[model samples]
Target chain A: MASAERIGIRSDRDILLARQRGRELGRSVGFVATDLTLIATAISELARNIVLYAREGVIELRVVTEDSHRGLVIVARDHGPGIVDVNRAMQDGYSTSGGLGLGLPGVKRLMDGFEIHSRAGRGTTVQIAKWLRT
Target chain B: MDVPVLKQGPFLIATVQSALTDADLAQMRRLLIEQVGKFRSRGVIVDVTAVDVLDSYACRTLRDIAHMTGFRGAATVIVGIHPELAFTMVQLGLSLEGVATALDLEEGLAYLNARTRPTIARGNSPRNSAGPPRNGTHTRGKR
Candidate 1:
């Protein structure tokens, strides 16, 4: 079991770096090409949210196993204006940044396990994981 | 890095050589639209063969480029979306609605040529009158 990797997200460049790292981690966890793309895309959406709303954040990538099943986990954390309405944020086509509003929902759909913790004026944290299929 | 936009006859082709940041995509959009108007191009092809991920921002930028270029009287086609990327995009609900896509650069050019032929035939512009002949070779069958 290798240690987790953390990438600071402060700009658009960090978004790219985070996703690339997520893909590499997913590959090491035995994810296929399609699954790796899914993981990378999910990371991009999460990291972009940090850049767009928080202006700074960290993306933590880790490889885990449970009962012989291998998986990759991603945790995106930011200390910025948190979500006023978590449910609304989860809804499709509900964007506050004039975006497509598919970021959170899209990430949820891509990963097998999804969790979000946020507080207004405090920050937001999203944890997503994808398990490898045996 | 800036994506290189090459002028191919009456079209502009921008090839994305690697993973592009959001800023890079926005800049490319601006450049493509500017060059399309500057060169009076009839079509634009964005080749993303080397891009490994097409996230929401990238997808939206491509669609915006297509729409913006369309307003300038040039059609836009996105090419070289990997199979895995396409699947992931679909799952993410990034439909890329109203944006044309092809398998690769060749198919994109063919589609663009087929689409632009009718307007040229209608004598929209005398400059494009000497464009490629009306051959059936460029016609993509049943797609």
Candidate 2:
């Protein structure tokens, strides 16, 4: 397995970079075209959130294998003004940025596993994974 | 990268050559809206065949472009969304609600042509008699 790749996210350009890298990584893990799109879209949402809410963050991508299944893992970490209410943030159509409010919820729908940790002032971290289909 | 917006008769075609950042998209939106009014275009087509991903921001920007251009009496059509990208966009719950979409540039032009035909037939097109003649020859001849 290749070592994890890390992309620093600060602006909209970083969001695109992270998404491209995520798509490449997912493709290398044998993800189909549709699945790769999903992974890339999920990465875009996470990276954009970091840029919008945290100002700066890092997205880490890795390939993992467990037993017979191979998967891709993505971790987004940022130290910025974090979410005050995690539950509300997770809800669909709940955005504080005047957006469509589909960022977090959309990311959750795209990935197989999702986890987010945030504090009012401590920043935020989101980890998500997608397993390759046999 | 800057998207090239070409004037096609009473329509404007903005072809996105690659993945555009948020700022680039915003700029494209402004450019499209401005050109639509300046040229008195009856329709606008955004060709995204080269774009590999259309995220929420991109989708929102496209929607805005459509809405703003509509105010100028021009229809907006987005074309060349990949099949995979479409699937993922739906899964992400992202939608271009008011924006028109088609399979490719040709289809987008076809849609726009059909959409604007009624206005042209009614002689309600923004093009005035003092402007270039409305003959069919000038449609594809202009930049």
Candidate 3:
């Protein structure tokens, strides 16, 4: 049983580092290959979005376990022009920025539990969870 | 991600150096579509063999590249889709529809070579004759 955490430094490099942190932490928790892959994918998406949309942001990775079941929690927050249309962004073929607007919805589908909060001109925060054995 | 340039006959082959996740898909869309339109080439080979997973986002991106490249009068061949990833994509029931994929980079290059080499052999291609395709296992597709 192990526990660890990390914070993204609001830079492009930090996005990669955050994803690496997710893999490292997942391995520390003895996560199997499938679960580890899921965590890595989710973390990479969130981190990449932070760098792409916002000038900078932070990412938090935490391990979780319940009744011997283990998992991961990934939280990515960014200070950027918050999304004006959350619902539209979630649509598969819809993209305002025109770059493959699959960041949020894609990551949400990859992980087990997903949540988002954003306000215009304020900032955006996204949290994702991946179960260990799922 | 470290994408290495490999030369295969009349084609410029390059393996993707990172996972072809949603984020990467977004970037590649711009690079391969908008940017590639500015230049002319006989063909472009993108080896996604290094990728371990493929999702709707990544697949859609590849499809877009193929379409754009075709519009530009250049052929785009997506090579080296990992078997596991391929299975996952099929199982997920998400079809990319128009993207061409080979088993490995070599095979992909061969496919391109078969099409482009004839043109190059006639000195129509910019690259030289009697060359083979470049191969590298790069990029992630696990998302």
Candidate 4:
């Protein structure tokens, strides 16, 4: 899936803009209200993760179609302190810092597909996809 | 800048103007607690009618604000959560247990009124007798 839209997640304003863009693209892909929320909320979660942990990142949303399955794909990339324990990060209520640990796991539950790549000191990237008929 | 606050009798109504970032969220929390204290209000209505998305951070901020205000003896009610946004928030594993929700601003005010003095009984059936809801227009019948 090629990049349909690219958003830089640097500040609070960028996160907001990313949400708006994600919502629009979701709508363009014929996602209903709940699915739209899923798309936009996922983007916000990823962007906020960057701002909170890495301090900056990039969000890429793409339109993907395979056979008869059509879905929207979102990729969030951040170049900050990467996650040392990917499996632990995916667990519910397992936040590195002292807060409700619902960010990554929540995203995984919302999307139809999810993948995470990270390094200890390099960066991290999260990719998620939501289908229309699912 | 602080989120806009409108004083209504003993209740303070804070309409979130737009999607908030981390810094703005912190600032808004400070201002809201301060306003709640300064007004000595009994209830606070956080109208999130203009917001399009409620992320994890936003949900946490709202919950924290509710807790802090509750510490100050003010009841907080969140009003006008876009239906889609609400559905998604719940799906994202956000319960928002500390904060209460209403259909619109009017209902939020009425909810606070009903809970504050505990004298006038509130209406059970929701009418939603107001203009169109703001922001994405996803205000459905009830929560």
Candidate 5:
């Protein structure tokens, strides 16, 4: 089990750093250019969620290696007002800010694995992984 | 720093430099609209070739910026999107709805230029000219 590297998501600039770090980590884990960009964009969306929804948060990047499988994992954690409705939030065109509301759905489509946990008043944590083997 | 909205002839070119902070993004948006109003420019070319990342906010802002430019009667072209970013954006479901994109800065400028030039005066565009198409993308049908 590889230890995760943490990147803070406090501002827009922080999202840029998170994306860069995610891309670099994805590249090191043997991801193709397309996969690298996907991983980075996923991080960017998640990190911006922290800044936009919650005030701030953290992103943890780790590599997954199991037997013959290798992958990149991302964990986004935010301790802000949690989503009241996960189902509605995941809808493609649902946005509270007059946006296209493509963040959550798009992130899901990019990664090989996705999961989310949240408590109304507590916070939210989203974990995503992209496998290189298959 | 002021995001330079340069004027070349009748159009405007806004190049986003690196390390743009949240406040900087706001400033650029404000200044871009201001410059468009001040110069009454016909079209705008937003060059993001130097940009490496496109977050959710960045994506939404871009789409919104293009819309805003349209409201001012100025056509907009987004250029220099990294190939990877474009691919990822498509996966992200960010249709950008009504945005026009180009491969590079030159293509963007040419697209905008070709858009504003006298359309009917060219005598059917020489269908077989040796030169590159005046419109790189965003052609014929118009957004």
Candidate 6:
């Protein structure tokens, strides 16, 4: 676990900017289209989720390397009404509202490592990690 | 942003390459308006297969295409949206509202073909003018 560079995107404009930043960071770490797409998608979903669901949130990106293996970790946390049932939400095709239900769960599946913690009436925190080839 | 043309039967199939980002949205919106001005097309089948995501901006652009094409006596259909991507959108609570979506490319073209049926409009200009410019409909939906 290493320190991550974090940013806040309160407005929709910031979301696009953040994604561009993520892309630059991803490239420096040797991420290809597949990895870039997954990271970009995950970041977009998380950032959009924050803009839509919470007052605001933070996006954190960190570089992780060990044994010649390089990877990136992304964590998004929102201080909104926490999810009551994280498990139920993780279930594919389960959506609270109308659109596709792939936001959180989709990001989880796309990443190499995923962890989420949310308490009712509290806030929700999602962390995702993806590996990069040297 | 690149607009690649694939010739289908009796119609030009325009596939928008790259993600339907703010830039592409702007371009598509312009083309749609231009198409309406020219009034010379059977219909257009938009293949979004290469696109993995469509934001609110893209959604607005799609809506614009559907509306503008309707006025031009042509129709548009969106196809190849990944199920997972669709699912995520649903969760995000974004709505394309009336824009048609197909499971695959073939299905999308068929839907557009079926809707080539004509509809009339008095004049053609952009509607839903309140939102900020998205894809470079500059000073309007400009990105």
Evaluate all candidate structures by whole-model CA lDDT and list the values in order. Answer: 0.91, 0.89, 0.67, 0.85, 0.82, 0.69
Model 4 has a clash total of 0
Best-first order by TM-score: 1, 2, 4, 5, 3, 6
Model 2 DockQ vs. reference: 0.73
Q: After aligning candidate 6 to the native by TM-score, how far in Å is the CA of B66 from where it should be? A: 6.2
Write down the RMSD of candidate 2 (Cα, Å).
Answer: 6.2
Q: Write model 5 residue lDDT over B40-120, tens digit each, in one string.
A: 887888888877666566777777678887898788888898888788877887766789889888999889888777553
lDDT of 4 by residue, B26-120 (tens): 88888889989898988888888888788888888899889999999899998989888888888899888968889999899888877885332
Model 6: reference contacts kept, as a fraction: 0.05
Interface RMSD, every prediction, one decimal place = 0.6, 0.9, 5.2, 1.4, 2.0, 5.7
**Better candidate by TM-score, 1 or 3:** 1
Docking class of 1: high
Considering only chain B, report the TM-score of model 2.
0.82
lDDT of 3 by residue, B1-143 (tens): 44555554446566787754455556665665544445545577888866654554567677877888778766788887765555545433456677677777777767776666543445433342234433332121221
Worst 10 residues of 5 chain A by lDDT: A1-10
Docking quality tier of model 2 = medium
For model 6 the local lDDT of residue B71 reads 76
Instruction: State the lDDT of candidate 3 residue by residue for A1-134, as single tens digits.
Output: 34767676565456556666787888887776665655665676677677667877888888878786677888888888988888877766566656655666667666778889988898888888877664
- CAPRI band of model 4? medium
Q: Reference contacts recovered by each candidate, as fractions?
A: 0.98, 0.88, 0.00, 0.91, 0.79, 0.05
lDDT per residue for candidate 5 within A1-134, as digits (tens), equals 23468998898788888888888888888899888878988988898889988979999999889788899889999999998899888889887767668889889999999999988989999999999966
- Judged by lDDT against the true structure, how good is candidate 1? 0.91
Q: Could you give candidate 6's per-residue lDDT for residues A71-100 as a string of tens digits? A: 888888989887888998888767676546
Per-residue lDDT tens digits of candidate 1, residues A37-126? 999999999999999999999999989878988899899999999999999999999999988988899889989999999999999999
Q: Compare candidates 1 and 5 on DockQ and give the better one.
A: 1
lDDT of 2 by residue, A43-110 (tens): 98899889888899999999999899899999999999899999999999999999899999899999
> Which residue runs does candidate 6 get wrong by more than 4 Å?
A1-4, B1-42, B45-73, B77-143
List clashing residue pairs in candidate 2: none
